[model samples]
Target: MTAFPLLDPALCFVILTTAVLAVAIRTVFAAVVSFIVFGLLMAIAWVRLGAVDVALTEAAIGAGLTGVLLLSTVARIAKHRADRGDDVPILEGPEPDPAPTDPLPGLATQSLAIVLSAAVAAALVAAVALLPVPAPGLVAEVGSRLSETGVESPVTAVLLAYRGYDTLLEIVVLLFALLGVWSLTADARWGGQPGLRHLARPDGVMAYLGRLLPPIGLLVGVYLFWIGGYRPGGAFQAGTVLAAVWLLAVMAGLVPIPKVSGIRLRLALVIGPAVFLAIGLAGYPLHGAFLGYPPAIAKVLIILIEAGLTISIATILGLLVAGAPEERPS
Candidate 1:
């Protein structure tokens, strides 16, 4: 029924190939790159399935942010090994042999892993095959009451209005995650900046992009947030854009990294969840249920919540990428 019949099959083929490559590749960097490609392809698949919100989320957090995190972790590990005078090189030349203590898994262990993977795949296929035709879903119910949620976009309505509790918890999780990252800071670096200070040449390409792209990225981020009430864009995608901009600026030496313990920084990190919780609690007294928005001002309330979440999400994501505080320069 699709307009591009071959397109779907081609995409699926490529996705499967990349997934296999991601797992089979010997180099960590190559595997990570393959994984990122797979995430991007999956985002496209979501779009094809007509879930634009999910597509945006997959592209932003799944591919973009997660890829960066993995790449950074790999780099850090390589550097740590090199600093310790291990045989491993720092991201260049041939990979060193695995440490004797960390030998490859025996054939029995490999066979067990293969069996478990095949069993899980078979179970998933059986479950899908057994699903009822037209699959039971709440589409009709959601559509019937969508107007009451005050958001034209069903995705936004579900996230910020109908199931606001889950959204609030997600933001709280991000706050908690950032707290966990901060906890890794050493006593000597307890109040220091959250990331290493970059020193980029003023005339370099990175510096140029840093100075230029942030203004454009800021506009895009705001647009995505503002349109969420009526379209597919929302807080998570907007926050990711803003966070990337901040990270880019920092990496290009256009701005100094903020200290993890700063009062302003802390406020920025918690304000979204705090605002969301306060509004949800107020709903109980006003509408007789938690997260129940009264008809007249429901739109306004949703927008306010999204605004708060956008700020908090952006700050938390940026800090998460920046990581825990590092020792101050002597």
Candidate 2:
């Protein structure tokens, strides 16, 4: 009744070659594009391995969000360079001869890297293709134990129950990364260009698309979060989508940058990690373990943690995109 899918060795070769070439390229823009391609190929690889959740995550976060972040950083760096007069325009007079480039570090460095990468990849491939499957794989065991953990999917069970501490730490890592970026931004002035000017309401196709798209995006994002426990959808993906919606709203001039970052904003930003850590600590007293939600209420706790994480992540992303503090409108 069903047809089986065959693996294409040629496709695998092409993808791997492309990934290597992308890394080898010197240009930042080309490298970014190549990385996005690499992520896409990796998503395909995940699908081939029958990992739908990983594939979705790779597509959404790896390829989509990371690409946007890279482009944003590039634009910011370009602007900074222009402001500092680091880049000079070429004159239209006679074509000037190009300057000779200096040699990179050393041959040993490149050779060492190449050898190491080749050896590692070969070893991994050999292990996968040549080694026999273990009698009782850990994956099967975990899947079987999912019911005891109050999670339907093995992935969810592992993330929310068996290894929840790691997930909690990951959320903290996101928060820390956000804080680090904010700190590195320093006290520089944005010069009144809040980056929201381009999002102005205008009469044309742009306005029509803007009006039509955000509602649909919001709906999709909410749906993803609601179904995350049962499906591939999860807090990280939903938060990113919600952040996109918030950014779109700001760009459309529907929501201006709020200058009054009083108590509320701070609380929203911190509450997610705070509540998560508190629950983890509370678990130690109740269950003699950290971040171990009781089976009776584990599902609800997971949902609640995800909700907080989504809100915090979205808010941080929006603020980072806006280049807050310096550009906040009074």
Candidate 3:
């Protein structure tokens, strides 16, 4: 019998190599960079798999913002080490000596991990290979009912109409996660400035780039949101772009961070989820089901929700990367 077709040769090689480097690299900095590279590559894989939404998400959040966050943390950790007199630029744990440890994973643990990984991979391959040709799916169902949601994009229609609860819970989960991050703050630092205070030179490349990038990024992000009503982009993906721009400016010291306890900041944080819940509640009285909207205004309501979610998501993502506050609660 003929063997099933193999995975893409070049993509497979790169993914495997990156996967190894991400885990096997000795330095934390190298590992993080490797992981970021891996995430970008995975985004490409998602594109190849015909998932534009997943691809956008993977690139923006999984790769872009995550890389920034790790780099920021690594920089802080490195600075803390250097402040204690170590002159090396290499990344290790929070120690000054910087003595190197074993670069490889333990033999037993590595073996077990490899075995589990291979088993899962094989199972997935076999499942795909054995799937019936032209397997039944929800595509027709989605397409047929897309009109009911009053949205042009089937993905958007399903997300806001057929599965609105899932999206609502997702927003709540993000806010809750941020709350957990805040919980880690020292009591005195509650509501203080979040993340490290960057001090970029006035004429520095970072400062210039920070000033330059946000305008373009903001336009692109909003464009994504605007087009998402009938395209692959959406609030989450667009919000990630906006969040990244905010982070860039903050990291370059082109902007200041506000105290988390500020009423405006607090309001910004909660507005999206609050609006979403209110809309859902209104649905019961107006449309007879939670999260339901009048057929005539379904599209408009969805857009309104997306707009609010975009703002909230951008703030949340930026703050989450900024991590817990570190100064006095102002």
Candidate 4:
């Protein structure tokens, strides 16, 4: 029995150790940085395991996008601390510290959480190490039939054509998450000057970089979207990259967020999932199953779906970063 070199057990052991150390450390910044490294290593493991598509997604979304999000949150929190003159208020109003009580209950809860996580991890390891290989038997059959489908990649074909419903549902899940986030901060107005006032300055290196980056990002995003049918790129991947550039522009005050979301913004945010669902429901009558594409127009439909999804995803991400119901230029 042989293990994939990138997926070597020893490498995984090292990753787990590093993650544990990061989590146990008291420094929030260190923990956030470690998570980013963990995401990159996970991508490497995926590539080694012969899942290039997943690896690309992990690298783009897990490492790149997530790291930015975490850093932004950290920056905001740090600024808040500075404004408050302290990170935590030590029971203000001259209240005396309560008599120290037994720490047993907190200790018990922490111990329980640790034990349960350890048990689950051990079980997962045992299952992976002991289970017989199941995918090898099916992958050969799938690969052989790949040519029969118009899509070049088996993963693409399966995701876009054979199991489109799953993709459709996943988009719905994304929408719901956005809605949930919106709900969480419903009353909080997102538009105002960010703590980084220098970001609004126009004459510095930041302005120069902001002026230069968006067009390049747009081209790269379009290229990724077009090439995804046969390559590692896709709508979701492209959208995230594009969103980051958009976010940069917003942060640098080059592109001001609108106070009220315009018709175009609203449309872009909903069009992808709406079109996908409409097509899926329509396919039941026309194609005999939900999300089943017609023979002559399947490729066209997939492209259309991907395009809508890309716009929607990018808009949602931008809005998330804006953290406002309607962002107005500062």
| Best candidate according to TM-score | 1
TM-score of 2: 0.80
Q: What is the per-residue lDDT of model 2 for residues 155-267, given as tens digits with 9 covering 90 to 100?
A: 76777677888888887887777666556443553222235345465765656666778899889888877787887777777877887887777677666655424567667
Q: If scored against the real structure, what TM-score would every candidate get?
A: 0.92, 0.80, 0.85, 0.81
Q: Write the per-residue lDDT of candidate 3 for residues 1-330, one digit (tens) a residue.
A: 215345556777898899999898778898999999999999988987888988999998889888888887888778886798866665744224436876888899999999999999999999999999899889999998788788898878877778889999999999999999899999878878986678788799999999999999999999999888998999999999998899889989888887888888888788888888888999999999999899999888899888888999999998999889998864
Best by lDDT: 1
lDDT of 3: 0.87
Q: Lowest summed lDDT over 10 consecutive residues: which window, candidate 4?
A: 87-96
Residue 271 of model 1 has an lDDT of 83
Which whole-number lDDT from 0 to 100 does residue 161 have in model 1? 82
Model 1 off-target regions past 4 Å? 90-119
Instruction: Report the lDDT of model 2 for residue 255.
Output: 64
Question: Which 10 residues in a row give candidate 1 its minimum summed lDDT?
Answer: 90-99
Measured over all alpha carbons after superposition, the RMSD of each candidate to the real structure, in angstroms, is 2.5, 4.5, 4.6, 5.0
User: Please, what are the lDDT tens digits per residue for candidate 1 over residues 163-252?
Assistant: 898999999988999889889988888888877557789899999999999999999999999999999999999999999999999999
- Give the deviation of candidate 2 from the true structure as CA RMSD: 4.5
In candidate 4 the C-alpha lDDT for residue 215 amounts to 93
Model 4 lDDT per residue over 11-43, tens place: 798679768866875566777788888888888
Q: Model 1 clash pairs? A: none
Candidate 4 lDDT: 0.74
lDDT of model 3 at residue 12? 74
